[model samples]
Target: MFTGLSAFPLTPMNEQGVNEHEFIRLVECLAEAEVDSIGVLGSTGNYAYLSSEERARVAKLSVENAGNVPVVVGIGALRTRDVLANAENAQQAGAGGVLLAPVSYQKLTDDEVFSLYETVCRSLSVPLCVYDNPGTTHFHFSDELHGRIAQLPQVASIKIPPVQNDLAAAKARVAGLRALLPSDVTIGISGDPAAATGLLAGCDAWYSVIGGLYPEIALALTRAAQAGDTEQAIARSAALEPLWALYQEYGGSLRVAATIAELTGNVSQPCLPQPLRTLQGEARKRVEAVIDMLSLS
Candidate 1:
């Protein structure tokens, strides 16, 4: 479940809450495309905004519609108690795995972060992926800390942030982490822009945002890298540079991804949660232009 393309689809929403039909369609789309896994309620899925009931329902819907594709549900929360509840909900919904980020209001120490994983791991019936998304969680994991948490039971994979653009440097960074982790624990790469680099550098998986929207293209790139076709993988990633630039310009992938979903009619006009608006005016136009130019459906 940790290996290959694990697409993180957005949890399309409406005034009535989660757009169940659209969410199911998105899951089925990924399943039809044969992605290695479907990650519902990730950052891209707006997991932070959804209530516990909504999250559990989303997990159930995703698992129900994902066909044979394994589903990994995000179980992040501010308090450990809430995190455990979320984890329980995911497990009850039949999630193949759970992704946990060290979400916090105040800064968390390494010990606190480690304890969080230890506490959660004890309760998780399914395997857990350590989500090292410092961008959102604000708690960065050192190699030492990652080693410590990875030693715990039920920890199957560690989703590291983007590595350096330089392939050699990326390889060294991945190798360093691999040496610390147990042989059974896989290393999955997030940060879409650096996916090719990370995969070509010997990472085991791509926890992708773009993959959720365009699974065929993303899967091609992932397969190329995993097959050791370095030139093809790099070229494929370069082709998506425009989209990656949009991610940088738009501040993050959430707005851009929501824009794509809307543009493609996969979701309603206002799919994001309140206070988090989709791309508008010229920004939306730019995204539309790129989508058309790139022939992205």
Candidate 2:
């Protein structure tokens, strides 16, 4: 379930809360594309903003609509007790795995973070993926800390941040992590811009944002790299430079993704939760221009 491409779709919202019809459509789209797994309630799904009830519903909706695709639900929360609840909900919703980030308001010590995983792992029936998304969670996982956490019984994968762009450096970094993790535990790379290099460098999987929207192209890159077709994978990634630039210019993938979703009519305009607005005016124009130039759906 951990290997290959795991597409993380946006949890489109309306004033009434999660737009179940649209969210299901997104999940069905991914399943039809035959992605390795569907990641629901992820950072891209705005897990942090949704209430536990909303999250439980989203998890259920994703798994129910995803056909045979394995569903990995994000169970991150500010409190360990809440994380446990989310984990239980995901398990009940039949998630194949759960992704947990050490979400925190105050700075957490290594021991505190370790304890959080320990407590959650004890209660989990499903496998857990360590979500080391420092950009959102604000808690960084040192390599040493990662080694320690990977030893936990249910730890199946570690979703690391982007690798260095240089292939050799990326390979070395992935090699170092490989030594720390058990052979059964895989390393999945996030950061869409660097995915091709990371995959070519030996990371086992791509925990992809772009894959959620453009599964065919992302899968082409994944398959090319997995087949050791370096030139093809690099060229494919290079073709999407304009899209990656939009992510950088917009501060992150969330706004740009929501913008694309809106532009494509996959979801209603103003799809994001309160206070998290989509790109406006010129920023929106640039995103549209890039989408057209790239012929992105």
Candidate 3:
């Protein structure tokens, strides 16, 4: 089972709206950090904005740079065929596994959700991780549903994001689900700020986006927690909190991605499409100051 941190690098867009070399360089840094794994074209990867070709190219480059580290491609589309195609391309590009979200369009039932996962598990030769992002999906999974998904032979893990309400309840649900699932099946948490807490709650992995900028700190925190040093983990997490604060300040994923790109020197010009506003004034200045303090770029 794969454990620890899995850094999801942001997919960059050049002036020509192309994913540039700078983006690939960022993934290489994560490889240098020796993170447990890499998730390509994930929500943080801006999977929704890129063209199919662009998505495949990013996945290929991510895997190549990742070397021995496992690369998990995010395959979430409105249609089943599209999701399958993406998965096929990731496999062809040498991805270690595929992380799937429920098809983003239309209201889907629990049966449809399981069926989508079952089909993907049956179609792909690689491992599968279910992304239970209820914030986006608007449909939460029950412990019984989670256990059922974990029982599938090809399904290896589940990615649960930290919800705003009743975190203790959510953590308890994961603990109970973990007990019900096979010993090999891992339960991962996706929120970067609550990573150490999630691991303490029995999550096997922390799927992170901010780690792209401070992979060493992120990895250190996870190691500290796994080694039973809560003080060490808490101290490292305290130092790492500013980066997460920047993400929250932006109030959007694009700015979060831009902050990461700027911190890593991945690209000097990071732009967001329609709907996602740009950072400016006090907000941009504050983010820049934090970036400088970390000396990440």
lDDT, candidate 1, 146-170, per-residue tens? 9999999999999999999999999
Off by over 4 Å in 1: none
lDDT of each: 0.95, 0.94, 0.77
Give per-residue CA lDDT, model 2, range 207-280, as digits (tens).
99988898998999999999999999999999999999998988989999999999989998889998899999
TM-score of 2: 0.99
Candidate structures ordered by lDDT, highest first? 1, 2, 3
TM-score to true structure, per model = 0.99, 0.99, 0.91
User: In lDDT terms, how accurate is model 1?
Assistant: 0.95
Cα lDDT tens digits for candidate 3, 65-155: 8867889999888888888889999999999999998956678888988888888888889888899887677777887888888888689
Error of 2 at 44 (Å): 0.3
Residue 296, model 2, lDDT: 83
Clashes of 2: 0
